[model samples]
Target: MLLRRRRFPILQHLGVFSNPRSFLLHPLHSPQYSSSKRNREQLLNSMRDLKTVDAALDFFNKMVAMNPFPSVKDFNCLCSIVVKMKHYTTAISLIKRMHSLGVKIDSWTLNIVVNCLCRLKRTVFGLSILGLMFKIGLEPTVVTINTIVNGLCVEGNVEQALGLAERIENMGYESDSYTHGAIINGLCKVGDTSVAIGYLRKVEKRGCKLNVVAYSAIMDGLCKDGLVPEALGLWSEMTGKGIQPTLVTYNCLIKGLCDFGRWQDAAILLGMMMKKGIMPDVQTFSAIVDNFCKEGMITRAESVIGFMVRMGVEPNDFTYNAMINAHCLQNQMKEAMDVLDMMVRKGCLPCTVTYTSLIHGWCKIKNMNKAMSLLCEMINKGLSPNICTWNALIGGLCKVWKPLAAKELIFTMQKHGQLPNLRTYAIILDGLFKCNFYSEAISLFRALEQMNLDRHILIYSIVLDGMCSFGKLNDARELFSCLPAKGLKINVYTYTIMIKGLCKEGLLDDAEDLLMNMEENGCPPNACTYNVLVQGLLRIYDILRSAKYLQLMKGKGFSADATTTELLISSFSGIKGENAFQEFLQKLVGV
Candidate 1:
């Protein structure tokens, strides 16, 4: 044993001493040193294979447990992982936790959270976070301010965002291109084009560079608000300033020109865009196509579609739908269906409006079965029919005097959670009246009143006419009385219906009062009112009032027809030889 101890080499002793276990046992290596080494290894491994927020959070928990303190970089990485996962609430919670633990957060980390909050539509909470950052002696960078301003601007709160931008400038932070662009975009979005232009001038005065996006935003806003000339001037200014128009810029101008009915000018602009190496986009083609269709130039519209396909620009659903509507309007059903088939072949799905247009076309031809079949096909294709489609079907049914079918269609609409509009109710009511379904007509009229939709005087007149025809003059009078309380001034049709109802009932006194009221309300009676009244008075043997009305009718440039002369002569049958009555009758017949 003594010989072995003497024979051990110093190299072996150094090797034994360099082992980690031996170092731990040595006085030079404390327990803290071993623990720190273990923690560092774990932290390195965590950073190497990190993928999700949960793993990052677990690693962060272990790190804080090991050291009881985290660096700013460690806290930022954890928060970034949370933001990347869109766990905004959890990210905010981590920020609060990091603050409580006295971990310093940088401006970049604050901006990340602020942007996440704004993207989540939690801008109020984001502003509070900004205030908290200020309270903790942290300054928001220009980028952070720009994010807040852009969020507010997109939300149409440009004034508040501008105030915040001014505050950022007052804090000695230089506004970058993004900052100015956001403010200009916000102002323009809210229709404050004048302010937006002034701000643009200020940006130029301040020597900040203006990009194409900012100019395009202004141009889009100007065009949207019908300031086409101003927008065109700005476009010229932009080109002169060496900024080329983008696809969006040309699209805005094309759409604006189309909206203002300047189709020829829009075409010229399209040619100019092509010559200037600016390609027209789908929106541009759609605008031109829609304009041609609106002008009833179907040939021109089809030519535009061909031109788009040749240019390698495929039409979108809106483009196809517009052409289909044009074809339907022209009653070219076969062409419309062919376009729909083409749409399907191109892998483009037809929307409800496509089917609705086809249905309307079929309805126009009184082909309700074809319309119904197309509607069923739409439903089977998973395109739900809208109110317009149902309206077309119902209106077509009513047009063909199929009121029962129209009522059935109304029930179907209600089952699908679509209530008929006032127009729908009006058509149904008019149909019922024309079909002599007076009871149903009056019931529908009262139903409209119950639904608070009877304020329209036209609806009242329809019901009154039905009542007069059905000899429900009292009901007509009651409905007429309710019109004024509903704030509906009686129109010419209302007075005519009511006066005719009273005349038919032989109520001459009441009819004359209504006639005076008609004139008082500035609705001068037409020939129909005078003729009906004269016939009523003659039937009741009131020759004096009848002669007065006949004279008034003549004064109003109404010549009594042969029927009127015959009626007057017949009314004086018993008293035909009397002198005064005979003279009056003779004068009326001569006229």
Candidate 2:
């Protein structure tokens, strides 16, 4: 009965809250151990220097065999070191063995178990273990509870994390920097930057020195929300408080500045980060290059690529993709292909995005042969064609006046399990319209509506524009009237299209009414809207109303586009005020 009572009794205690960890290895039957204090010191130092999970396990097994077994602190220290290696599972395995051997476990040991469970994304089980700690006579500490809080934040259950933090604080426990950082980061991650900034201020007022993690996180949130200036303000405040910015801090601020086309500021920040010895990594340069590409500053992107080479920072896949995509967008296929070759030569494997961009570039120039060849090459290289890849080719086929070919590509992609998204349908609808398959386009759109797919406003615009340009004014008007019934908010573009259709049919009065109605209903006319209306009037030789709209365009600080200006100049034969057009041109060009 005594022997039965002592058979690994801690198993029952751990089993209630432990994971089903398959760590059932038995300790050696006659393991030897030295009583020499020097031997134990060697074990401790060796454990500290351990690098791999396998070696760490061997040390744990050896430690359990020591004559005067290492203290719980020694075992706890081994677990801590293993945790640093990010081998949470191995740490759990070690803990399981310790319990089976009846090594008196402490709160520190339970804290590790909680951390491992949480790191593995099992916060519920971690929370349960916290409860188990008390039942097994081990008091939970602030660190143990904070691990759960951080886990909750990581899993995006931020509201509950904040509530738990407050509950713990109210229970007379002083939360540390980790606790405060977790809550602040959670707020930022959930895109509640307003609440995050407020919480930051609240924490500062209470004398909690916000660390670099908290500042970087909130700065990231602010930057993502397009509040770059506000994030810069926080940056100044962070530096003013003598909190040294980390690589993450610099990366966030630099990326934010670059995104807003603030190149000079980004350059200055890059210099500052270098001066601080916090060298920007591959990600930082990639982001800067990406932003430069996005803003159509390909020359700047090329220059940055050169600078990256000079700084011994080899551009990664993102860097290559950005440059490739920028050249592709500008239809500079040679430059784009050159970058791809360089990427391959440098052993930087091109991803699906890489081929997709090249395919799109070739498509833009109506070179379906080159685009199709590249698609085959991409497949032969073991890269599967994504939806964007097919869309690029489909759009290319459409550009070549082959709507039927585009539709066939759509069916081919479906066979490959690459389902068509809304964008796919949008491209097809646009192609059909461009290729003069008006009835076919209408049928496809009707099918989409019948299927209850979320047909977006852009899709409707394509259909409306196609109807108007096809001289189906009555069909266009009926469809325009049905937009409001369909719960689509008529945007400025849609309103402009209707105005254009009305003017194309010589319905000058109705066109003028819709243009005036745009602002009354809170949708103001942009430069394009006014220009479209003017061009419509000029098409029918309505010089007087054209003059009125040109004056309105000037008043709204909108200039006439080249087409509108060309039409106005061409129609000046019926009017005596040719100087007025010249004068408007001068002011429009800031002369």
Best-matching candidate per TM-score: 2
- Candidate 2, residues 183-226: lDDT per residue as tens digits? 88988989998898898889888998878999999999999999
Error of 2 at 342 (Å): 2.8
Cα RMSD (Å) between model 2 and the true structure? Answer: 3.8
Quote the positional error of residue 113 for candidate 2 in Å: 1.7
State candidate 1's TM-score. 0.64
State the lDDT of candidate 1 residue by residue for 1-591, as single tens digits.
Answer: 232233223212223212133322233221222246666666745664677766765665555554545566766776677677776655655654454445655677777778877877756656766775676567887778888888888888888888887886897888888888888988988889889999999889988988888998899899889999999999999999998888888898889999889988888989988998988878999999998988889899899899999999999999999999999898999999999999999988999999999999988888898999998898898888888998899888887888768978898888878888877887788888887777787787777779789878878888888888889898789878988888998887788788889888888889989988888889888888788778778878888888888878877888666666778768777675687867875675563
Kindly give the number of clashing pairs for every candidate.
0, 0
Task: Give the per-residue Cα lDDT of candidate 2 at 175.
Answer: 81
Model 2 ranges with Cα > 4 A deviation: 1-45, 63-70, 275-278, 372-387, 411-419, 573-591
Single out the weakest 10-residue window by summed lDDT for candidate 1.
10-19
Q: Against the true structure, what is each candidate's TM-score?
A: 0.64, 0.88
